[model samples]
Target: MRSPFVQLLTARRFAPLFVTQFLGAFNDNLLKASLGIFVTYRLAEQSGLGASSLVMLAGGLFITPFFLFSGASGTLADRTDKATIARWVKLAEIGIMGLGAWGLWQQSIPLLLAALFGLGTHSTVFGPIKYALLPQHLGADELVAGNALIEAGTFLAILLGTILGGSVVLFDRGALVVGGVGVGCAIAGWITSRQIPPAPASVGPDAPRPRLLRDSLDVVQYVTSQSKLLLPALAVSWFWLFGATVVSGLPVLAKDVLFANEQVVTLMLALFAIGVGVGSILAERLLHGEVSARHVPLGGCVMAFCAVDLYLGSLGRPRATELAGAATFLREPGSWRILADLVGLAAGGGLFTVPLYAILQHESEPSHRARVIAANNIINALAMTVAAVVAAALLARGMTMGELLGLCGVATIPVIVITAWIVRRGLMKGVVRLVLRVLYRVEVDGLEHVRAALPHAVIAAN
Candidate 1:
């Protein structure tokens, strides 16, 4: 029997879309990584800014567009053919990358930063289209599998892009090489995008028009006003908060706490990303192609445990005499334990997210689904920014990274509880009744919705 991933990979419906998504993610991260390196090494001296500050500024630029544009993007996707928007987004990526390449070649920070913002906008537009388009392309049975493959592919692409970009930027003609890679990937993404079959709009002409400020506010209101949309949206945002914190913290954790070098930092990142990819695939297998949040609470538990364990592990580590590289870090006492915690945390995260995304797509009104997802994106961006600020605030207040991590671990409990509360409370604590009322004829005829909404089976006798 062929796996769903294999089947989907070969299917025209999914393959081209997958390639397009993978290449887009790869190209974005590649440009960002190379830009970061360039900023850190060559530009810091001339630009009168510290290397770390410049990198953070770059990150800010990249994230700003999602905050501002996701609502309009989502509205646009919901109002038109999603696949068409995707192709246009890809075409835009080529020009964005061209600008970025020129920025890199000329060592122009302004052009590079502008390119980053453009890339961010590109991502913002593509985000809702992909999620909203999936339900249209894949079957009920295949939605989980399709989402899994995309999630896995996305993280893997990010990992590879980061590694490749950082490595390629250190060469003699690094700028030129990096530029070529970025532009080439952009063109490739555009090519693959052209092959994606049409996913036309389901909503008719009366759909809401796009308004930048109003749309942003309206989308968020749409999400929060409905408990079903609200739950998954909040949960998704929480995951990003956790993810942004963990990923951002790795460098400091590696260099100072673990006394490890850049290689160790990369290794830690690989473990995190790969673990999420593994868990995404695992979620599909475990759920057997069912879309449900049944295991999300369990996944949250696992994540909490692993995060706390990591904090405990990092607490007593004996700092090395000098900076440790990958090999030495692996051999050090308590290293594997910490690494295991990283994997476990990320795996749990993977398990936690796939279903929530399914919920966002599965539960939403087809007419407004893209807008709902757009709202989620805005919330996610805010959550990540909050995570950065929270981390910075805690670290500045004399908390060690381990303690801050531990704080994050502790924070996970409420997020999990709140997610559960929303799931259960959103339905007024009557899972069975709610399931039958809301989802029975619509989605849960398959029973996945019932199993997903309730924590466990309820048995009552009068």
Candidate 2:
């Protein structure tokens, strides 16, 4: 008797959480996009660091915190009321933005990098709470829709932030503009954070907390012990690894290999981001708010295929003399192929990621949910770092971007194959069936009991 959209919206727990999460993502991306642009133009020019070095430094600053703090962050989420944590995290974001504003005023590369690290730390701390709290707030039936909306909102934020950052950087007072916007976004995010209803702690407040190192090790041990959780987490980590490698290499590829300009690179990024956003939203419908773990295998295959095709497409790179403006880049015969590949890769990425995330959220124990997510963030950060190193190595070795991408695609194949094998194992199937049966019982209690009892009685009579 309820409209579908209304039903989704009227769900008490989800509504506030969705708004809170969306704003958080929006703010994060807004700040990150502005910072990325600021680094690209102002920092590199003023600090005497080459553009590449500046970019890499910025990336490193943002990623390092995840490696260092995600585990601790996860534990905190498990130990606290998530709504309280979300509020404090938002407040922390405001302080981080203030530091960013200071960096902008001084144009101090070190300060900016430090602020970036602080921001990353804040994000890392929030990671586990963000994901872990969802299952607490929403029923299993709502998870897919909730996650899809989150993914869509996050991507939309990224797109908006990137566009805003790009526009602001062209201004004479770009730094001031970016700083003001970041501060404003942080404030808005904080305000939204207040609306999130309290989520009860999963563990006892008086439970003895482990030391940091041991706590992190425990998170890893716990997650790895559950195959349903472990496989998806590993698969998600690999997606980030593959993506980081490609995206980090894209600038170099665009300039050195594709012989294209900055605008082209930006456009390609936009295309990929948009594709991912669209694909993520579509996953909601495809998954129907249930366990659609098979999407991971399917997405992995598509990703490998598209990556290989992109590599092949790049084999006949146009000469430097053939370089063109953004308009011409779009109109060129070969450009369409590249664009298609980018879109496909982006779509595949969305398909690959959303399900894994849903599975992680769905399978994790509520108390340790945040810690599990923190582990995911840690792995993602590590994978990205490795990707950067590998990309640099490939570049140093004089491998063309296309060739490097091809190699990455080839590398992904083995990972995907292994994931598929794991997913197909009897143990995994048994676990999945058990989870599904439990969920089904929860959904249709009397009917499930009747079916089970009737089947048992029939077997006894036989």
| Whole-model lDDT values for every prediction | 0.86, 0.75
The worst-scoring run of ten residues by lDDT in candidate 2 lies at: 442-451
lDDT of 2 by residue, 321-440 (tens): 765668877776677888888888878888878878998998887777888898778777777788878778877888888888778778878877776776666437656766877877
lDDT of 1 by residue, 1-462 (tens): 999999999998999999999998998899889888889888988999899898989999999988888889889998899988998999999999999989988999999999998999999999998888889989867888888888889888888888888888878888888889889999999998989899988788798778887898889998999988898888878888998888889988887777889999899989999889887888888778876777677678778889899989987777667899899888988999999999999998998898889888999998888999899999999999999988898888887777777777788898788767655643353456557678765332446666666787674544
Q: Candidate 2: deviation at residue 288, Å?
A: 1.7
* Model 2 residue 255 CA deviation in Å: 2.3
Cα lDDT of candidate 2 equals 0.75
lDDT of 2 at 220: 79
